[model samples]
Target: MSPLGSRVLGRPDAVQVWRNLANARVNYSVDEVRRPSWNIDVHRTALPAERPGPPEPGGSWEQACRLVRDYEFSPPEIVRALYDPAAPLLGRDMLLEARFHGMHFYCGVRVTGVVDEVRDGTDRVWGWAYETLEGHLERGRATYEVVKRQETGEVLFVVSCHSQGAPTLDRITSLGWRLFGRRTQLRFYHRCAARLRLFVEAELRGREPLPGRSPAVGRLVWAPSDTRTHHRDALAIHRVAPG
Candidate 1:
């Protein structure tokens, strides 16, 4: 550990720290992760339609894709992400604060791939994926995608992942995983997609989505440049997931 890891815990340089960690490799063997046994999950939700072509300019598909790019769609009540916004989304390093029954645990993940393509006679897809890094609670890869149909102009948000628990030194977390992990995992997958849908729907309705966190909680400083404080200054009547 460097001096930044000292107990004093001053505001260390987040950009530089992430830059350094970006050089580090993911925790698990990428080769084996694709083998059988890892759990796979996929969730999809339809959004408002646009003209049958590329996503409408500034339409729901584009806005939803923006949220996915910046990690804004993540429900903070479940996970709060911190990273270098200045860095390109691909290969970016993320430090995630995953919340469980009120406990906060830190883990690391690195963006592994990105998807942007037009195929199948005119459909367009934009998305990216990240894999768990060393010290993560699990070994996994999750992808976020936004698809716009050419013929019908339908938009959809999709999340797919393959995951399994990893060995860790924390016994309590292991016990918690044994007892409540599956339930919370399902909740996370479902609610994350739901939250993204909520945001895009609100925007399509000509209103801003409300903040998912309390003003007081903004005082908590974890990164040098915290870009994950996503909700605020948006007009809305919608409520985010409760803590």
Candidate 2:
């Protein structure tokens, strides 16, 4: 038997304190003791660790459209960067992939083909035709635009998607001849516009600050006027500290 009670008997002050206690004579028995279980140390083999599967390759045009629509801002920059006249066409595929990956944020319209027809002096007529795989067909139009440029081939104005039906193609061709003396940069404009619109919409929704603007500009630009008014009202309620 362990001498647990005798361990405290050596302190005279503790013994005196215990003796002065009211009703400190409670008693106990050794029947409460139990044996320890020593047979429960069995080991088992560990299960294999789970690993993530490979990233999904976005393959469908619809998937591409969704990616473009959902993408925040970066994909638009990629599209704009690809717009440079000097950039090789290989970047177009990359731009396409960016659009596909960011479809939920950007317009998921795809340009299937662009044709440039040049006639007269400096006047140029361009045709840009695209379709939205994700939106209603009524909302999507395969459009042709008439572009007028100076004699130096500088684009001055654009008549975008003004006409309808198969006959509108011929009308667009005629209008191009009437507006500009010659066709110079037709196909380029069509491709550039489609890609640029996606980029612009994405940048706008993501509240990206314009070039040369502070990062806080995004907050200012994105905040609605009503929100600003509400914030101003809230701040007006605070007391000004003595300066």
Candidate 3:
């Protein structure tokens, strides 16, 4: 059920895509990526937060955290998330249907790690990271985190990633990636970071979350801080009707 003139993946197609992507191995060697090399590109950005100190239960911080977990922070202009509704975010597999210049590209990524901890009684942090799977256009890992300083209650949405080119058998595709991939990747990060900030700020003011190209399914819970696992249920976001 793609849109007219666009290759938008539907639920059934997404389900099948998930099956294939889940089995693909990481395109790059994790061990090799750890080595210092100029070939890798690194990026980081800090998103704005409302106040300083631990966020109130069911408040903006909590709400924003849930949104991040569900991968809803990504602007639909860049990527479409295709995930299994029954799965938990921590280890979820996703098919990212990336769109640019009226063309579509598909890639796979999976949650490789999750962090939930307090640092020296001063900060509470929660985050997860994902890595590119086989056949992906790029090879790398990205980490996203929401951090709240206990003393000041300052919350920040932070994004960081390291990426490099995936070996391509074709010369033309490889050249194209070399010329434009980094620019596109940076743009995606910037937009998504900005979008998340907007959503968090709106939730803090009890205003409606801004609408755009992104689509989410099922009911959403705005706060994850109130109950430890509440947001996990909200992460069950599949667009198809239940059987």
Candidate 4:
């Protein structure tokens, strides 16, 4: 069983360790920035192409790959597609598959599980359950918005909720240091696109999100820029519309 499973199965020490890790806080510095194009190149070489099989029945590997590509380039498009009751089964299936695979949309982190509570007129809120490979479940939530362009009918945004977790924050920052050999902090910038790609692909493929899967991967080609950073910051400032 996984460490988290072990703890849930009655390992007190494991549970305590998990809690301790979750509560710890650490600080990270932004060492550098890269654009999404650059980050993508880095991720392409770093992340292996070995993909897992898709879910049964309606799910297929090709469909999963398409979902990943679509969501990666245009989150709002995927979200809009899902809102369609008559959309292909692949859309709905991919969402559920992503949850099981430990992938978080937009951000490049793994989620343990997700509960969607979207209603008419309300922004969709997904209660994301997080767990470490060792079986530690940390608590977190994410909200999503589907933005549309007024003039072109083009989808512009799929704004996501801000992520917060004492344990997760610490571990991810620690990972940045360990992997980059610098005290790098995590940000919602384009620099993370490479890392994000791997996780996103994994989610589509119905596999658990594994960090450091491509430890040697340099960086994403399309790393975030000041403009993109500001965009995310702006979105953070606005409240998600209620469902």
* Backbone clash pairs in model 3 (N, Cα, C under 3 Å; residues 3+ apart or in different chains), count: 7
Name model 2 segments beyond 4 Å from true: 1-107, 120-122, 136-138, 142-154, 162-243
TM-score of 1: 0.77
Model 3: runs farther than 4 Å from truth? 1-12, 34-53, 210-243
- Residue 163 in candidate 4, Cα distance off native in Å: 2.1
- Candidate 1, 119: how far from true, in Å? 3.0
Give per-residue CA lDDT, model 2, range 97-209, as digits (tens): 11111111111233444545655644444444443222111122234333334343232223233111111123433354235311222333344344434434444346432
- Stretches of candidate 1 off by over 4 Å are 1-20, 34-36, 210-243
Ten-residue segment with the worst summed lDDT in candidate 3? 220-229
Taking the tens digit of each residue's C-alpha lDDT, what string does model 1 give over 188-224?
Answer: 8787778778878898888867544332222232331
Which of candidates 1 and 3 is the stronger one according to TM-score? 1
Highest TM-score model number: 1
Give TM-scores for every candidate, taking all chains together and pairing residue i with residue i.
Answer: 0.77, 0.22, 0.75, 0.24
* Position 65, candidate 1: lDDT: 90
Candidate numbers, best TM-score first, in rank order: 1, 3, 4, 2
The lDDT of model 3 is 0.63
**lDDT at residue 48 of model 4 (Cα atoms):** 26
Model 3 TM-score, 2 decimals? 0.75
lDDT of 1 at 104: 52
| Overall local distance difference test of candidate 4 | 0.26
Candidate 2 lowest-lDDT run of ten:
37-46
Q: Residue 217 in model 3: shift from native, Å?
A: 9.8
